[model samples]
Target: MRKTRAVLVSAAVVLGATLTIGATPAHAETLAGVFREHSECERVGTRGTDQGWWDDYSCEWEGRYRYYFLYA
Candidate 1:
């Protein structure tokens, strides 16, 4: 009764704090890596002109399709 309730509350608190400490740092590290890659691209002239989310290699072949499109 009372002992079970106290145990449950303590367990919940511990789990929540553990999750928070583990997840937040990973998210922050990912964000920092993205920013670093973006800045590196800016420094160079390799900015991919494509804006689609699933175009894996479309950026590097920007102008190559114009001639080949007539054959397709």
Candidate 2:
């Protein structure tokens, strides 16, 4: 009887651990906006950085610009 109880307890513990490890939270990717002008893009990038997000900016021509924010 003692041996059976020990085996059951061990099985329960292993099952609990497996369930906990298998359950993982999902993260969603967010894309902010395509801000035109250099200053606008810079502001977006700065905001992203301040919010603990990875920031990237791109420019096309003189006034066209865009910023991308990524979260890990």
lDDT top scorer: 2
Worst 10-residue lDDT window, candidate 2? 63-72
Q: Count the backbone clashes (under 3 Å) in each candidate.
A: 0, 0
Candidate 1 lDDT tens digits, 1-72: 999999999999999999887875522211111222333433232233243322122112225432211100
- Write one digit per residue (lDDT tens) for candidate 2, span 6-69: 9999999999999999987654334555544557666776777788776443333333333333
Q: List the pairs of residues colliding in candidate 1.
A: none
Candidate that would win on TM-score: 2
RMSD, candidate 2, Å: 8.4
**TM-score list, all predictions:** 0.37, 0.39
List the pairs of residues colliding in candidate 2. none
